[model samples]
Target chain A: MSEGSQGLLLAGVGGQGVILASMIVADALMRAGHDVKQSEVHGMAQRGGSVFSHIRWGERVDSPLVPLGSAEVLAAFEWAEAVRWVEYVRDGGAVVADVRTIVPPGACNDHRSWLRRYPGIDGELFDSRHLKTRLIDATATAEELGNVRAANSVILGTVAAFIDIDNKHWEAAIAHLVPKGTEEINLAAFRIGRDVAEARVPQTAPDPEGFSGPHQIEINHVWCKGCDICSRVCPEYCLAVDVDGKLTIIDAEACTGCKLCEALCPDFAIEISAPREPAVVGNQAAADGSTL
Target chain B: MTDVKTYLREWAMPHVLCPGCAHGIVLRSFLNAVDQLQIDQDKLAMVAGIGCSSRLVGYVDFCTLHGTHGRAPAFATGLKLARPDLKVVVVTGDGDALAIGGNHLIHAARRNIDITVLLLNNSIYGMTGGQAAPTTPEGALASTTPAGNTEPNFDACKLLMGAGASFVARVLAANPMDMTKVMADGLDHPGFSFIEVISDCPEYFGRYNKVGGGAEMLTWMSVRDEGVAGPLAEKRFVNHIPIESVPSGMETGVLQREIRPVYAGVRKVEDHES
Candidate 1:
């Protein structure tokens, strides 16, 4: 695991499955056993307004909301939205943006004219029409996979390729989160995305001083409701309840604080806290998603 | 009851709520009702209007509809009609339900849809800087009503009963015991059931009315009577004269002994409309 935290922002208009895509990424990270917290804003969504999600995954996450200007990955379904949140990405952060610009209302008399003002924004902008970008088009891929409604799954697959998480862990998380009868298509989309990200992302030298030291806990009793939801959705089966009805952490090392258990609990009796406190520092990274 | 601590998301959950806000109490009571009845988790649908109280839907994990201001009844109506198996509950503030959505409430009660309406009447609109609401007391001062409000307020339970609601009751948010009981009973009612909860808006209504703090607001509610009325009472008004007068044809009492035939019956005639 990296020593520092990783922040990702998912931005798009409502109904573009931005929330679902954000969930998929967060789910994959949790499966890899990384600490994560995600915050979603969706009020007045019926009016077709802009929507954004903040995801912080790594060592530990406290506040679900990330402070401005700390995103390492900014994935946008639309081009203008990508520019809108371009300032959040830290220097050297990766941005995998879609270039299929759908002009928002009041941008201009025409949509194309409205889109011309965006290239000036920073970061490596990938044309959404790029062959690699096909994985980002989950809506199209869902249809190809025999269900037009599974488009959000496609974008998740595209995002899988960029982060440092493992692919099998993500596959297992998808298998857990998604409904049955649609696993094959989602896995295919995810594999394609991994291949693309591996091809495009440059390999960085690993930090010798990665996360280390006394950051672990021994929870005596975990009163999980025996609902297979956690076991099903977890990429790592770190969660288990012994015969005595106490929940057990099978692999404490692999329990990411994604708080998916908190989100999905029907009875609502699970708690997960970050193992370590996070520190903030000043950096001169360009506001755009780049390594300038 | 599901322990609130366990159900809540651990993230610094938004502390947007003001101290001693009635919306929180209303939300707690609501959760209690659902827990006590053991309502099928998947079958519970909540509809909310726009107000401090309406925002209650945001924190909850159920299938919630944060519809437009004052249109929760209309939305809940459509939701219940489409999915008859689902138990729909509408939570609205006084302003949202009586002022802007008065017509929807009247029609829903008149049609008697199998929906439960939790009307949180704090007598002021807390979300929009504490303005005068339809239920604001005749002489109560508000942000909009500098001197005092001159308009009469609607008695939600009485209005619903007169509009043909099958079940009606009123309780104060201060009395969690009775409030939870009334909520459960309303949800169990087979037709449009109206339960008006006298909630305390400590931030706006309380400070403006000089009712002290949230605890003081609850104290005010504790002294009030449950205004129970008889069935054939010739003109039982919601308000008493001398101190102040507001015209409300609703008397405090149960209206119907049994649930009358409603839209569901009409649907039955048509073999159920989807």
Candidate 2:
């Protein structure tokens, strides 16, 4: 909402819904009035490799990259990744992390002997140095409320508390970002994550100049075969991919009317247009939901 | 002497081709051959069937016909018969030349009609979204066959030679100079000359089969082309050494050349007099 930008880092191993979680947070930031710039590590994403999303939001964000140790928030989908990306967090930045620990294979040949030799705990995560940390059992919370897949949503909600945005905006983001039928449980997971993180102090406020405008551009999801070509070509780094590998808008406000994405699309799936008055949701049925 | 650009109907262009398509190179080679020969443009008649390569007939400044699907040879036969003085050429894609039009192609070669056939082989039916064609390589993925095509492909050059074509050559789109030379030679050949161009359809075929787009496909073709594999080895090894063997790679040069009796539906005056 101010002159300066906000940097957030999202890190996780592949298949943990890290990209989708970042998409939700980034979309909500744009709706709350900032020009969001989002970028992700797409390589080695299918092999359970380290993945990170760089999200920056402001009136006029110049770059999609977050310089090392400059991020205000680092949301880790797993405790091991929490320790892995802890160095990226600014000294005063907040970290909302999943308490679940996933040890890489071969790290400990025998879990029983390793558990006895070194019990896993917060302090075991080599000194976090001065960065503020709030570890949450988001997986337990999500599974208690019916779907372990919503663990990503719970972690996102936990991170939502450290950032300055209304609960309603987060609700709207979940509705627009998540698939159709799973909205109810995912929202429940979000609320649980927020309640779990209520003890922390929010370091920033929603941008007073944040984009409270309509979404521009319509994608004929029917033509989108989950190709990353459009997302890679967006001039303002506004397009992002969802869990299904389809393109989802991250910062519609950052669009400069450049039709490169539309023109380069092999399927002609993207169409740039003026924002509608009603702020209609995008082609929500995924590509299968399009007019095949 | 008209150049290739001059031969092109400027108003009809620019020719629609997707990024990374080999069809452009093949089309350019054909135009370059026509340009090099300084052939009579007014007397040139080109017939094409329905497909991406068939669209070539619409852009060339010749007496061109483009509506028939897999029946370009049938149309070319009629054109050559009616105006025996015209230098007629038929262009078709793998599907058009070897599938629905297979019979027409074999018959055209059998009769040894005085015409040239340019078979643009991209391996799959590209215009219809990467369907498996008769020329599609075995085990390659197609839209209709998501689990890899189980059917084998046709070797157009061998098939044409078996059907008694007077001139048969196989060329690659990557080697434009050689392709043009073969094209010009085919045009100059007296009886049915069939040139099979190993071209690429990157949008559909390349995408579905995981083949690197046009450039990579071209690079592969260039490397796969082991030049002049058949004739010389046959002369040196088989006839001289009394050995029986065949070359391993795709034979590149002209496979066959012979003088054949042209079918005109009637005996010539010399034959009648004799």
Candidate 1: tens digits of C-alpha lDDT, residues A207-286:
11222211243331233344333443344455665676455667766554554443333233344554565312122122
Clash list (residue pairs), candidate 1: A92-A290, A138-A151, A138-A154, A139-A151, A222-A247, A268-B6
Runs in model 2 lying further than 4 Å from the true structure: A1-292, B228-248, B265-274
Task: State fnat for each of the candidate structures.
Answer: 0.00, 0.00
Candidate 1 DockQ, CA atoms? 0.01
For residues A1-292, what per-residue lDDT tens digits would candidate 2 score against the true structure? 2359888989887888889988999889988987999999957767666788989887889888887787889998876677677777787788888756555433333322333332233442434456667777787788898888899899888888878877788889999988789999999998888788422211111111212233377786754555454575464677877997677889776665555565444333566754455222232332232211
Per-model interface RMSD values are 15.4, 11.6
How many steric overlaps does candidate 1 have?
6
TM-score for the A-chain in each candidate structure: 0.54, 0.61
Let me know the TM-score candidate 2 reaches against the reference structure: 0.45
